[model samples]
Every structure is written in structure tokens, then in C-alpha cells.
Target: MTTITVSPGDLPLQCLYRWEKERGPQVYLTQPTGGGAVLDITWAQAAQQVRCMAGWLQSQGWPQGSRVAIIGKNSAHWILADLAIVMAGYVSVPIYPTFNAEALAYILAHSEAKALFVGKMDDTANIKNGVPSGLPLVALPLAPALAALQWADLVKNNAPLSGQPVADGDQTSTIIYTSGTTGKPKGVVHTFNTMAWGVSSATHRVRMDVNDRYISYLPLAHVAERMLVEQASLRYGGRIFFAESLDTFLMDLQRARPTIFFSVPRLWVKFQQGIHGKIPAPKLKRLLGLPLIGNLVRKKILKGLGLDQCRIAAGGAAPMPADVLQWYRNLGLDLIEVYGMTENSGVSHSTLPGSRQTGSVGLPYTGVESRVDVETGEIQMRCPALMKAYYREEAQTAEAFTTDGWLRTGDKGQIDAQGFLSITGRVKDIFKTSKGKYVAPAPIEDRLVLHPDIEACAVTGANLAQPLALVMLSPDAVARSQSSEGRQTLSTSLQLHLQAVNAMLEPHEKLDCLAAVTTAWTPENGFVTPTLKVKRNKVEEVYAPHFASWLAQGRPVVWADAS
Candidate 1:
């Protein structure tokens, strides 16, 4: 087995060159098409494509520090464009394909992206309409809507770059825009040195090597997916597979047979639900009790999940349910929970391979110094991989760091004597869905209250499949709902209002149900704080016991039913 060693000064393109020379024929990526075709590209071929793309980009004579944006799903060409931008001395700005027109426009305009690389998109028309005029558009092979120079055309017409251009380790590598709790998304700037340091630490912690294979399904724009799947692969020389689409995820996973698997808790729950759908919980438990049968069943279950060969399975982005972790462990797979943030280049803490602690997100990684703030209990850390600053936001950057210069993680956590960190809650009011998307309740609550019928609402969904909005009807609205006919009309209006509200929310932030409490909440009921603010936790405590029932009702609006 060969071990690849990379230094901070060594650009990723240089690593590709080494791989091309040492093992040119080795398959680097497997790109699947919706038509059931699989395209296997070798290291030599990928290097040539990247070189050609980079040369073409350089020929454009874009100024240094220019921002080039890539919006696409996880694919080989997406990565090729990223490498090309970096090697051509431009910074890459990756936008999530699912981003609405508003988000897409903001990122491009804010980043000052000179060019955009478009790939497979769910809403091509929305993208076409959102893209500002005069921004150069280069369509990838899979982009069916854009009438621009295709990726293949560029590769065929341009010559491969002959030599690696000198790129300083301290130069900005990319600007990753993370959704914020207010206003617009914030751009997190990372230098080549930051990325290199982070990836090196992650690789060391995960024990990655050349023989590993990864399935790239999550958005490449996200720092977690980039680190675990893309950056780790580049640093350690691992083969990567791209899923064709969500519908074929299982098939793609089976084909990849990845040695390294990383997914968010939502998908983990879906996997559990999928297995339970096939094999009921009680039946599974009974079957596992039998010695010979249990072993066979476990192997079968893992094989079906495409994790039979997985060496390192990890869940991150949000807290994974302990039961779900135990379920995987029962099948002999230790699903490690990783904790990190984009500001830290996704380097912070991760549970070691065999050190299984159900709720804790393991010890800090090498060179990461962590402490619980005495006043706020927020987890703070300092590391070499921490981003230099938020792009164009000096005030926010200053606020992110403590007086002592440590990065505040904004997560309330407790460190055990054993050094394992358990996240107690978020310091901010933002709550993350199972899919790991953050929902800022304030914004959503503001929208909900605008409806004349709704007086106040609290948005909550901690560890839930989706967020729920607890609605309290206004007095006039409640007075009209006494009659059966009036109640029906109100329900209809509320349903319509719910739909309208959902239309404005991101997929993960969409409410699962609207529970309208008959009793009014006020300061007298202790549901309001002394400052006249809603005690969100108190409201949740009173109604949380009914949440499962309300969720199970499956109605968009479930009225108090006959018990």
C-alpha cells in the first residue's frame, strides 16, 4: 500500500499530477447517468480534463482573486471546474443547486462571481431567470437548459496546461456561503493552507488511505461533504462515486460499495425506516436474539443498506438519535458522530473509530483546543484551520471570535471528564431539522403572525423530522370559530395560510404541522418571560407530550379531536 504525503504548500493540482504519473490508469471517479450508463474516468483522463479546463480559464485573462461560481449536483465535472478555478488562480464559489432564486442571486452578486458553471438543476428555468445578465455561463455536460459552451467542447478545443502555476498556501482557496440566522447568507473565506491543514487533520483522525472509496451524494457546496468526501479523497487518493439522482441513490450506493460513508441524521433515520418497512422492529428484535439467525440477518441487513463493506461510517451536520446509532451498532457498524462548523473548515471533533459513546461527539482533533465558556457554556475552540474571517463582514468576524481569539462555536455543550463533548443545546434560537438544515424561528414566526387570524406562534422542532409552528389564533379570529360552519371556514383559511407560509420556506424549514392551542398563552400562565417575550421552552414543555400525536394525525391542521 502506498501512502500519499501532502504539504500545505503543495496545491491539490500538484497531487493530481503525481497521481497521474504514478497510477494514471487507476479509476478516479465513477459518474452515473440517469440513462443507466456509468462513466469511469481514470486519473489520467481527469487530469487532462482539469488541465484543459484550467488553461481555458486562464486564457480568459481574469484578474487574480476573481470569483468563479459552480452550481451543480455532486459530479466529476463539478469537481473538475473547482480544480480548474483553483489552479487558474481564481477562487471557487459553490452554490447549492436547491437554493431558491433569491439565494442564488444573492450569492452570485455578493461574491462578485465573474462566471458561473451550471450543471444538473431541479429548476433550470428558475436558474436561467435568476442569473444576472452579462455573467458568463459555462454549462456542464448534464445541464440541458443552458445554451452555452459545454464542458466537453472546452476540453476538446483547449490544450492541457503544461505546468502547475505557483499558488501560495496563504491565498484564498474558496468562499463558502453558509445560511445565516438573519439577513443574507455569510461567506466563509478559507485559504489553501486552511483547507490543507483541515483535510490533513481529518484524514489523520479518520485513518484514510489510498484504498478507500467514497460515495458523494451530499451537496459539494457544504463544508462537511467537501471535507469528508472531496477533500479527503484528493488528499488520500480515494476513488469517488457520484449518484445519478435521489431515486437511484440505493442503486448507486450498492454499486459504489464504499469503504467510507458519511451522511446526516435524516438520511440515517430514513435508512432505519426503510429497514423497518421491510422488517418490523419486533420481528427484527426477535430474530436478532437467535444466535445463528442473528448473524445471518445482520449481514443481510448491512448488505441491503450497501454498508456491508463500510469501514468508517459517520453521521454529522446534526445530532444523530442515540437509538439510530445503536441500531447501526447492533448491526456491527459504529456510526461515529462528528462535530464541526464551516468557520472551522469543518475541523473540530469526531469520535474515534472504535471509541463509541452514544451521545457525545468525541474528543477534539489533534491541535484543536476546546473549552466551555464559563459564562455562556458555549463551546469555543482555536485551531490552525479556522477561517481567516467572514468575507466582507468585519463586524461579524470580530463577533465570532472571543476576546482571547478563540472561535465561538455557538453551541451550548458540556465536556465530560473523559474529554468527550456532549452538545446540550444551541446558544442561538436557530434549530436544525433532521436533514441538518437550520431554521431561524424568528423569521418564520414573523411570517406566520402576519396572517390576521394568527396572533402569535412559536417554531420548534428540536430532534424532530421537521419543524412545527404552534399557532395561537387572535381574539377576533377565535370568536368567529364558535359555529361549525365558522370553524370549517377558519380551518380552510389556516390551511391555505400554512401552504403560503411553506411556499416561502426552504425545504427543511417547512413546517410539518400547525398545532393551534385553544388556550391563550400570557404572562399569567408563565408562558411569557418577565421581559414580555414568549417562553418558547415552557410552551414546548406543555405541548411537547402531544407533539407525536399531533404529528401522527397527519393533518396539516389537526383540531382537538375526541379522545
Candidate 2:
């Protein structure tokens, strides 16, 4: 693989022009249409369409710097609309399609978005109702339910925008609302330079080129996917493929054969569960332990999963279980865990390929300045790609930064002598017990979820004398626990599992009991964020009251039917 050098120009739009001029007919986006068909758009075509849409947006006479919200799933038109917003001198606000009507309304009103772009959605009527009464709506090509100005019609009717306006480096390009796991979403403001510099600098660590293919399945509204997939494609001229739907995800993955792939730990765990379901764990482990057949088994599994062609597989958004990481490594895949936040342009630490260390997010990317504060152990960073501010919230923005200037990451982490960073937990998530010991629940939960049957777990004690674990079992695990005999078996196994986990922890940090719950924590339930990180506060709010009762029962493991 030859190294591809990219001159990321002062603006991302400039890079678009450069790619259009050099690789005019090269396919830039491969979008999936209905009935197993795909629509390929070349670099030149993409640029022209963007310009046409920009011209239409300019004609709308929206004020400069006005917020124009784009609500949709990942698609070709979504990226085009984001670019058109920047080209038209307005700020782009991308909303998660999974957001409820209430969240949609909150972001629309808070950002004061003048125009709305609608794309493929599950509940079009509900989303449409969330749009402000007077906001102009433009439907993307696939959003047929929305009776609004069609995207393709506008592009065909308008002429290409002449003389694309150059954006100032400090000009706000987009306002990305954080997944409000704790409360209402706060808008994160990023400038053109922040996007360009962050993506370019981070891509240097992982080599990319026109030949590289990527699957854009993760919500592009998240900063990590936006930077890694969208901006990386802009900078490196890579071909991007979009997943059509959940049912066709594997087929889409097989079709793309992406060279670089990224997914949150939750999805990664699901993939593991899917494989384990197809092949029973003990048999699969025995097969993999064989010398001759192991290679063939791993290859067959990788090919089946459509990851045979993947070179750099990354896991982020939450701490990946070490056992899961090792499972992929055993199959000859280097799955690196990356660490970052929305305030930092999602460019922080990443494990290098072939040099991966499980449980660590690796060293900070080149040109990124990172340090752990002595007192709080909170990670602070100063970089060119850091967000400008939280939009319209000066008090919150001021609190985000230290008195000096470093962006406070709010994550408690430690850097080893060799510069590798390991996230311990969130500073705010640390809770004190009634016994006067402060406990960080993440490390404990991480250990608990290492059990194969456990899907997700949260540790909470708060005002209680000792901490207890609230666990959500995997689907298969839930099925196993349905019968009286199966439940007893699972209870015995998990009790021993908890004993083993407790053996490794200090007395103060040990979990007093484990409560196996029936309810699965999911994004739809407001228990997990879009990025798949468990909302610790939300989990504690629902389960803390039961902790004392469970502990008072004097049982090592208590089963709660929380469904």
C-alpha cells in the first residue's frame, strides 16, 4: 500500500475542489437504493450537486451564520446538505434520527434553525410535528413522506453556485448537540479549522487513500463518526458506502468490504453475540484452539462477517471489554480502542495498528497536547481541533475550560510513562458510599460485564453502605434464565463470577451484591447514549433504591424481574 499524501487545504471545500479536479470521475459515494440497487456519485458529480444545492440555499435568503438543521439517517444527500450549509455561509446542525420528538423540538428551538432538511426516518409524522411551525422544510431524495421542497428538484432547477465563499478558520461550521444522557442537549460549536485540522491530523496516524473504502453505518451526528468517516473521506478521497437498514447491515458490509471500519463497543458486543449464537461458545473455543483448523475457522468467520478485508478496525464511544478485544485479536483482527469527546473534535488517543494494547486508548495523536491534572486526575487537552464553545451557553462554556485554557475533558484518566492513556471513569460519576469510601463504578462494571452472559452492568451505592451491581443480561442469557432450573443455574454461575471479580478488587471497591435485571438498557430507553455509553446517572436513578433492599436480603446475587 503506497502512502497517500493529502494537502488538507485551509478549508474542506477547497479539498473538495481539488479532488473534483484530479479525480473527477472517481466514485466518491456509493449509496444504497431500494431493491438491492446502488447509486454511485463521482467526485465531480458530488461537487456539482453540492454547488447546486448551495445555490438553492443561497436563493432562500437565510441570514448568514443562521443555523440550518439536518435531521436524517446516513445517506449521500445528508453529507451533501451538510456541505451546502457551509457553502451557503450558514451553520449546520445535524440531529440524530433516533432522537425523540421532544429532543428534536428542543434542538430546533434552541438552535433557532431557520430551515430543516428531512431524510429517511422511522416516524416522519412525529418528526415533522417537532419542526417549528414556520421553519422551511426540504425533503431529501428518499424522504417521500415529507411534502416539502424535494432535494433533487431543487438541485435540478437551480444553477451551480458561482464563486464558493471562503470560510474563515474561526467561523462556526456546525453545532453538534451532545447525546443528553444527563439532561437536555448542549450544542457543541466547531469551526472549519477544527474539523479540517482534527480530521487531517488524526488520519495521519492511520493511512488512508482513494482505494480505501468505508462503511458509514454509525450515526454520523456523533463527532467520532463525523470526523473518522465523513471528514476523513473529504480529506483522503475515499469511497464511502452507506448501510441501507438494520436488516441488510451484513449484506451492506459484505458489499463494501471496507478497509477501515469503526463501531461502538455495544455493536461490537452484538457482533460477538451473533457469532456465539451461530456457534456455541465451548465448541467454537475448542475449534479455535486447534492449530490447523483454527486458521481456516478464523478466515471463514471473518469472511462471513465481511471483515476479511478490513485493516484497521476501531472500537470507541465506550470502554471495550478486554475479553472482546482479545477475541478479535485471536481472529487476526487488530481492533483498537479510541478515546475522545465532543468538545475535543473527537481527536485524542488511538492505538496503533500491530501495536495494540488492550484496555488502553493509546497515546495522544500527533500535535495533541494532553495532561492529567494532579488534583482531579481529569484529562485536559489543548489542540487546534478543540471546539470553540458551547453555542449560546457562555456559563457552561466557561465551566468547560480551566482558568488557564486547556479544555477540561471531565474524564478521569491516567497516562503511563510510555504515554498510553487509560480512562478510569468520569469524575462526576464517582460516588461516595455511606461508609465514607468513594467508588468509581466503571472499572467494577467493566469487570462484571466480562462474563459472557452479561450484556451491560452498572455499579451504584451512593448513600448505601456498600456498592451493588445492576446487570442486564444478553438475549440468550435472558432466555436461559426464564425457566426455574435455568434461573437457578444462572444464579449459581453469576454468584461465583461475582466472587471472582470481587477477589480482584479492594474491599472498599468490592460490590456487595449483584441484581440481575430483566430490562435491557438501550438507546430507546434513555439508558444508553447514542454513542452507546451507559448513562450512569440515569441507571443509578432507576436502580439505587433497590440496592439497599437487595443488600439487606444478605444474598450474594438477587434476581429482579424489572421488565
Candidate 3:
């Protein structure tokens, strides 16, 4: 699996010096901090911390295309300051340590980011008050700032050098931002020849390999987990691990036993409500429609979510919930679902490996090129890793391309006739309903978040007069309201699962109401946005004044009678 000709003088962090001159430590990454200490990172300590953090950012006079940024959470020095901000040629942006500080003071003063690398979390000592008091930072010892300079204090007495060696089709190498879910978040750039022609146009559109491992928890500051962790793990030389918190993500997915596990559909509806909170959806569909107890209850629920040696388990950003993709295809985990947008660098479509659909979003994407503007079915697309704009804004990158260019993905879709697609929502999450009927609340909160007592839901209404969902339950349904007979049996089983999800919605997107809040719209409550989504305009401005007496008393409504 070696092919070259990648050129802005050849880099993508020299694919960790072609895997340390071809496989050396036999392990690339496996972080599970101290108590379980294992840092691993090799390919010669990740090409000697990408040449001592690109030779101390070229002895700090910060020049070349200069931009830097790199916020926090998800580490290995958040991929060593994203490969020393592209081997110090510079320009990396990233921010999303759950943004706020006014969206990192507008992307650290709109990517004029001279430097910053913050990652360690609990908000890296308030990221230098969200950077811009003459921006320049270097903290990084997994960021709980013990007087900064950490990456072992900038390579204690630095050396292991290298100067220029960057090209794999170079253009700008990394920028990623957009999870602003309609408002601030913008900057979406890329280049190492548009991410090595999007990692060989997605390994020739999904026939991926190089013994693919991918288990790096999402928010590599996004763009489908930085094109599956920094350009398909440097164009598929794979193996990356990370996750060990969310209470030991299934024992760090059975100690990094990954083959390809990327998540999103709100963590695949909390792994199908953690397998219907331990079986019982008609006995987990009679043990997955038997015939060998359906591959041994889909190999014991993918070996209890260590994802039984994954082998491709995708789901990306949002829209996916065809009953959680037919309960991960009745547990055989071909979970698939993918559609893209970091302003088109992640993908243009997917859902292929053994044709999948469960309410589409798959197809196209081999050097992508799509359409659907059959008058606002929106979608458009074009990709060559799209972005090359939007960073410095230029009128929202000239209204996100077109006039013979494509890329307008403000999400609303169609496409069919075999080129899949589906989507049908997010033209600013659609609204209207005093009877002008046009509710589209993500297919009724993807069918009331496959009720295992939902863990997140947000279907607000625009000019009001209908659609309402809000929900945030599940901490095992608010730890069953710490008993008074488990809060009258979780308010009579969430009012009989919101009366069986409003008798399967449609009377003007029924769900006419349902409050239930306790606060799990996480990213430390700005009502979610660090890839866990929800900031539906800050949960309609922190629950629109406690949803005004339950929308002037119409139906459902209950966060203890709307507060």
C-alpha cells in the first residue's frame, strides 16, 4: 500500500517518516493516561515529535503561511499540534475545546491565530482567556497548565532536527471548524493536496486498507474525525486508539481492538440504548431473528461494544436513525451512514460496503460531484476537498460557492435514482407550522430518539404554532428519578413514551410538547456543540423562557410542568 507523487514539496507529516522507515514500535498510539499509563506513539516517537514541534515552530518568529490555533480534548498533544501545524510550514486552525469564550473569540480573532495549542481539558486553564491578548501560547502537557511549555517542556533541550520536507500535494494542510450548527463556527480549510486527494479519494471510494484500525473518539476537531484521524491515518497506515474515559469506553474498546469504528448518530443512539438497556426489544428481536441466535446475538452485542473487531462501523455527524440503522443491521454492525461537510472535505456520500440504506445518505463520492437543487432540495456538492475559502471569510466564502462551482451544502436533500442521498432536513432545520405545515424536525427527532428514554432530542419550531420536543433524559432516564418509586415510575414511563411517540407523529409533526430536561445537552451545556450537536440556537436560547407556559398550554409539556 505505497504510492506517491504527493507534492507542496511532500508532507502530511511525512506519514510519520513513512512509518518510521516502515514499522518500528509496532504500535502507533494507545493513550489511557497515567492510572493505566500507555503513551506508545512511535514511528520514531512520531517522527521525533514532528521534528521537535517543527523545530520550535521554526524558532518562533512565526512566518511561512502562519496561523496555528489547535484548541483541545482528544490528544497525543492533539496530534502533536496537528503535525507541528503542518510541519511548520504553518496553517492549522482547529478550535473546539467546546468553543465558547464567544466561540474562541471568533476563531481566535478569525484565524489570525499566531499560535496556541491548549489541549488537556477542564478547559485548559481557561485557554488564555480565549486567546488574543497578543496571541501566543505553548501549554501542552495534556493541558492542566502547570506553568506551560509542556511536551516535556518543548522537548527538554531540543534537537532531533529536520528542516524542509513537505508535499503530498500540499496546499494548506488542515483547518477544520464548522460545528456551529448555524451561527458562528466557520473556517473549513485543508490541503496536502486537498488532504492527499482526500486520502486517495477515500481509498478509491471505500475499498480501504493498510490494516485499518481507526478507533480514535470523534472530535479530532471533526471533518469526519479529521478524515479518520489526520488524513485516513496518514493515508491508511492505520492503528490509533485514545478513548479511555466515558468510563473506559468499553475498556478502551477492548484494548484498541479496532478495525474501523467511527460514531455519531448520537453515539448510535447510545449504542442502541446500550442494547436496549440489556436486551428486551421483543427479546432483542427474538435474539436478532435467530438462525444461530443471530450470529450469537451479533457476537454478544459486538463483544459488548468493544465492537467485536469493528471492520467498518461508521455513522457520521447526524441524520441516521432508520431505527438506528436497523439496530445496526440487527447487530451485524455494518452501521454505515456517512454524508459530509466541513464544507466538503470529509466526504460527499458513503454507505457502500455491501450496499446499505436504512433511510439513505450514501452514494457518489469518488472524486464526488452531486446535485439535487431541483429547486432547493439543496445538496449540490463538487469536492476536490472543497474548502480553500471560508477561512478568512470573504463574505462567507462568497456565499459558499456556486455560479458554476457547487458545494452549497446547507443540508436538505434528495438525489435518489440509485445515487442514494435522502436527508430531507436542515434548511436551517426547517420550520413553519401554524398550519403552514413544514415541520421536518429531523424526522421527528429521528423517531423520538429510538426511545430508550432518549438521551438527547431537540426539535424546536421557528415561527411557532406547532412542533416541540426539547427532551434530554437518559442518565438511564435521569437515574430513574432517584426513586419515590423511581419518580412515579419515570413519570409513568415518560408518559407512556410520550404516548408512543405521539402515536407515531404526523399531525403537524406531533410531539406537540414534551419538555423533560435535566441537562445532558453536553459540551458543558451551551446545549451541545463539540460534535455532540444540539445547539439548536442554544437550545432555543436555553429553553425559550422555560418554553412559555408550555406553549401557552396546548398538549404534552412536563419538565415538572414546564418549570
The numbered model that scores best in lDDT is 2
Ranking by lDDT: 2, 1, 3
Better of 2 and 3 by lDDT: 2
Give the alpha-carbon lDDT of every model: 0.82, 0.86, 0.73
> What total of clashing residue pairs does each candidate reach?
0, 0, 12
RMSD of 3: 22.2
Cα RMSDs, all models: 11.1, 2.7, 22.2
1-563 per-residue lDDT for model 1 (tens digits): 12334374345766777788877999999999768899999889998999899899989998998999999878988988998899889999998776667778989988999899998876586577778988888998777777677889899999988876658888999999974433567899998888788887776667887899999998888898888887877777889999999789998999999999998765676677678768988899999889999999999988887889998999887666666787788878878889898999888998888865687889888778899999977999998889999899999999999998999998888999988898865677767777778767765775676555665678899889899988877666678778789888988888899999899888888998888755666533556421133567777777888888889989898664321
lDDT per residue, candidate 3, 505-547, as tens digits? 7777776677778657787657777778787887887677766
Where is model 1 more than 4 Å wrong at Cα? 1-10, 430-563
Error of 2 at 508 (Å): 1.9
lDDT of 2 by residue, 5-103 (tens): 224374678878889899999999999998899999999999999999899888988789999999888998899999999988899999988788889
Indicate the worst ten consecutive residues by lDDT in candidate 1.
Answer: 523-532
- TM-scores of all predicted structures: 0.78, 0.94, 0.34
